[model samples]
Target: MQDYSEKVQVIHNEKFGRHLVAQLDIEAGDTLVEERPLLVAPHWECGQMKCAKCLQESYVMCRSCKMFPLCMDCQGHDDFECQFFASGGPGGYICKDLLVKNYGVCALMKFLLLLEDPSTRKDCERLLETPINLDDYRDGDGMWQEHEELAVRPLMASGLLMSLTQAQSLTADDLHAYCIRIDSYSFEVTARDGDTLKGVFVCGSLPHHCVPNTVVALDEEFNLKLYAAVDLKSGEVIYNSYTNPLMGTSQRQHQLRLTRRLECSCSRCLDPTECGTNMSSVKCRECPDGYALCELSSGGDWRCSKCSAILPAADVHELLAELGGALVEAKGELQAFESLLAQYKTLLHPNHFLMLDIKQNIASILRATALMNCMDQPSKKLLARRVELCSELLPICRAVVPGISKLYAIALFEYLLSLIELVELQFSEGELNKKEYATHLKTGRLVAKEAMDLLRFEPENSSEGYLVERLAMELERIESDIAKYGR
Candidate 1:
């Protein structure tokens, strides 16, 4: 409903194909762009029983097609799709069982339907196509076999091609190209009910950075809104991170390369200390109290900041691989994570990404235990540990992901919740006077307000958005308690 397109412009260069730049000076939190997705499809991993229309798990099937799943409320919504599925020629009816097993076929069908519209087809043509390497699939390690069986064979057997080709010509190669384009450019959006869906957007395909200057959010209908994460001067390029911000430099680079065919040399990626957070750092074996920082560039050796001891890049990679394997084997077990934390405490930096990951898992476990409403000794200990882990993570989150970040917001929320619980426990145990109780509640109110500001833009149906309402209620309760304490 609001237009911010005039505030930003798309530009092209030899280095980066297409990127957005600020047309005017923009303040932090300013809306820079808004657009709806050109195409939306269920994620490949969607469960078999999810309704084709609402994407909710349902046992009801479309009575007309008797193939596609649909709840009673969603029955009429699939009229056109149902007709096509039912009208396929002899032996052409797409088996409901097969469609359930191969969820990707439904997405391909949606793409083909969109291609039938001239304007939509033109938009799809403008998207960048990812080149397919046949050799990668030759050994059955790639998605080629899966695509052939699930997508190509099913479409060929259906009447979708006949209906779609009536207006314009299409070939098997064209379908393959469309698949690659979708894979390269689509965003994984969480739907209103938490189902994952892939969406391709025109303006959203542009900007790429390791440390993004913009944050993107999607509402219930998958309408995207991009906000400036930091203040930007006129003509400055607007960038968005394509990978997880919490990942180590090497992990982010590898994910970017694999997903987007990008080799990121962004400021964050180039800095060995990663803006002084040292998330990728390890302990220096040669010197006491020294840590080795990653050399992000190829074939560069890590050097100790205090002792100047050298560690080969290859050895660092090998060590990381071994640790990563062990972490996978831990499988979210509390004892396993404790073992990892104790074993790696002497080998890795205190804030190393791997160590942080294990701590996050531990915090999650402790948070769950603390929220169980038990005021026993073990519960209090778990609450204390949760508070401690969140305290350690908050500063690193601030250092690495400075402005309005989801990671920072969630950590802050967890920390504040733990702090509030501890305060209440202390008050109930007579550990604090009435004035102390009111003072702690006042502090919690401020923290809850901060968390509210960070989560303001989350979609109403999302888990984070739900937290906004919870924080508001929390603030009200804190205010009441503070008043009762006469502070």
Candidate 2:
């Protein structure tokens, strides 16, 4: 096995076949690994015009082929006769044109192209030859059987194999084995332009967890950096959440089986209340208080911990569907959003997924208002309320997503901006005391700095990148004002 770094080592076990474990004590926010993507593709169904090579916005097409879009720098590179292009001098063939429109086909094509390199091809073959324990994916459980017949068989027959290999052919069994490799080790690549693509990282061999201890960040070039979400002890297993961190336990498990093709027995998945976050809980109709805790078992009832109020599984699903519809229609309308919030206030816990959805929607409105520079009475009130809402959400975000996650970073930026504006508004009206103003200024500086710390890893031209620059300028202006004025 190829060693990624001194901080982590590869290990194999019966439950999770191959995973990474910490070698030394690591601090929170410490970088554990940095791996480049083995393959990258345009965002799935992304209709935006982009450079085929660099993935940046480009209007320039290859003059000879008129088929492939190229950024100026990539077009100017002298190695036009490289492996990516056909042998012709100027009108060389573009290899990527073989796969387009579909993200899965495109990504797979890129992976095959990567294997054309002798060194990478050898590494991939060796990695696939290593045996993995499949006791978790047995035939009797309906997991392995369904996956083989449905997913694996269809992919092998899809003609992607014949196209990429350039005349080389592989059997269904060969493709099936490769599918296992891809599903087990692939990373979801997020580009600098906010496009999401499936990527295979050269050193992305991490274990699975419903609540991961580490988080991954990527740059414009798709180079990945892993950061410790919490302080790590030596020899502890490092885990990555393959699914969204905010997903309820049951929802996460279902999604995981479809993607990772394994049943999760992680600590959070086994817990009824998801480690006391109550993310999957719903308020009992019979009981005035106490939430009905959901279980993974089909026969298991959402039994109220406090009372004997039983919620039928079907009813919970119905409520969730209704909540999704309401949230979708509540966009950009404060009254509709507030009504839904009021309705769900009693139907779900404060930290439940529904409530979080409403809070996030409200935050979006506040962000728009802040950007509009609207300081009318109602807008100022909204801004103050937003500051409180964000303050509440930030601690919860830190508790669950304890690293430099994009959501946490964005929330921090919005919160700092709101605070900065609120303080300025108060000062303009001469209603701010010097001490209080200074405190707000100091808090803004600290939060903005933290947000920037995370945003520095993002692409410069991306939305996060623009936010970082704006926040930095605001922070600098705040400091200058503080220096010029007393207190």
Candidate 3:
């Protein structure tokens, strides 16, 4: 096994399989692990044409295969899969349209090719594999059938995979097991252009947490880096969230169950209020002041905190679905979002996941409008509302996402911008004197600095890293304005 990090040690257990534990006290922002992927390929749902070798957007097709897309640079590098495609395997070459739609075939081909090396095969065998029942697919049986047609059958029919399987004493079942392992362990890496790549890392797959103590980032070249999101003591387990942190407890649990096939009993998962953020709570319809909280389980019933009213699990689920559908239909429209928020304010907890979603959309719309330099009364009110929304979100983000995270950093950055704009507007209309303006500028500088600190660990080429660069320029501008006002 690769020694990916000296600060952490891999530990195995009956429950977690393989997990990482800290060896020494680690501070927030500390680099925990860094490793290049053992295997990298286009994500299963990747529809955009990309060079099979470099994963960059490309229209240039390989002359040899005439089916696989390759960049001009990669055309000269003919590998095993490339040659097999050119040879038109036992069942003939897979059509380009089929390859494009089922990108997992390409990814699976890479995995099969890697297994040709005995050492690599042995290394991969050590990774965890979850059992997959094609009949029990969450999407439906059709998805599994489609996978069989688009990904599995094509690869099995390939002459390269067949020869390798026979030579290596591998069977079709082993191929299916390898596919299961890839599905279970592969990390989705966002490329520079925002497309995703699936990467299987050896040590990187070990850590697991619902509210992760570690943040993972990938650079332009897809090199993975793990950083401590919070301080950790020696012997403490390192955790990385497999799902989005912003999701509510039930939503997170459902996603984990669907993807990883396990129920999380993590601290955050067990908390009905989700660490006191009330992200999953709703207002009790039967009581004036009560909010209903529930267990994280899908079938858990909700109980009112204030009035002790009981709400059936079915009812709660139906309400959530209705609100979710409405929110989705609202899309990006400011008026629709405001209307939805108004309609739900009395029925949902202020920090409910759906409520937050609506607020976030409202804030985004207002921010875009503010950026257009609108200074009318209604526009100013909307900008103020945006600032208020960010303020509400930042505290919740701090409670849920905690120390250095992209969500918290983004909320803080947006809050900082809104505050600066609102303050500037107030000062320009003579709502504040020079001293107050300077003070507000200094405050804005602090907020900008905090945002920078949080985003420091982001990859230099990623979107969050771009925010850091923009924040630096904004900081300089803030300082300049502050000096001018002070003079």
The candidate maximizing lDDT is 3
Name the runs in model 3 displaced over 4 angstroms: 1-3, 63-68, 73-104, 128-146, 166-176, 295-299, 371-377
What is the per-residue lDDT of model 3 for residues 32-81, given as tens digits with 9 covering 90 to 100? 88877777777555567778677878877788866668887774433655
Tens-place lDDT per residue, model 2, 128-197, is: 7556445544434554554455444544544445444431476655544554566566676665456665
As a whole number from 0 to 100, the lDDT of residue 111 in candidate 2 is 48
lDDT of each: 0.75, 0.68, 0.77
Per model, state how many residue pairs clash.
0, 0, 0
Worst 10 residues of 1 by lDDT: 129-138
lDDT of 1 by residue, 1-487 (tens): 3345788887887665666789999888888878777767775545555676766666777777766777777745444556655665224534556566666677777666655555466665556332455443334434555566667666776545665553236566566555656766678776656767787776776557778888787776777888887889999998877888778898998887666557898889898888788899999999989999865453678989899888988888888888899999999788899899999999888889999999999988877766576779778777878888888998888777767777778777888888888888888989888999899888888888888888776667656678888888988988899889944
Tell me each candidate's RMSD, in Å, in order: 3.2, 5.4, 3.3
Q: List the residue pairs that clash in candidate 2.
A: none
lDDT of 3 at 395: 84
For all predicted structures, in order, the TM-scores are 0.88, 0.79, 0.88
Clashes of 3: 0
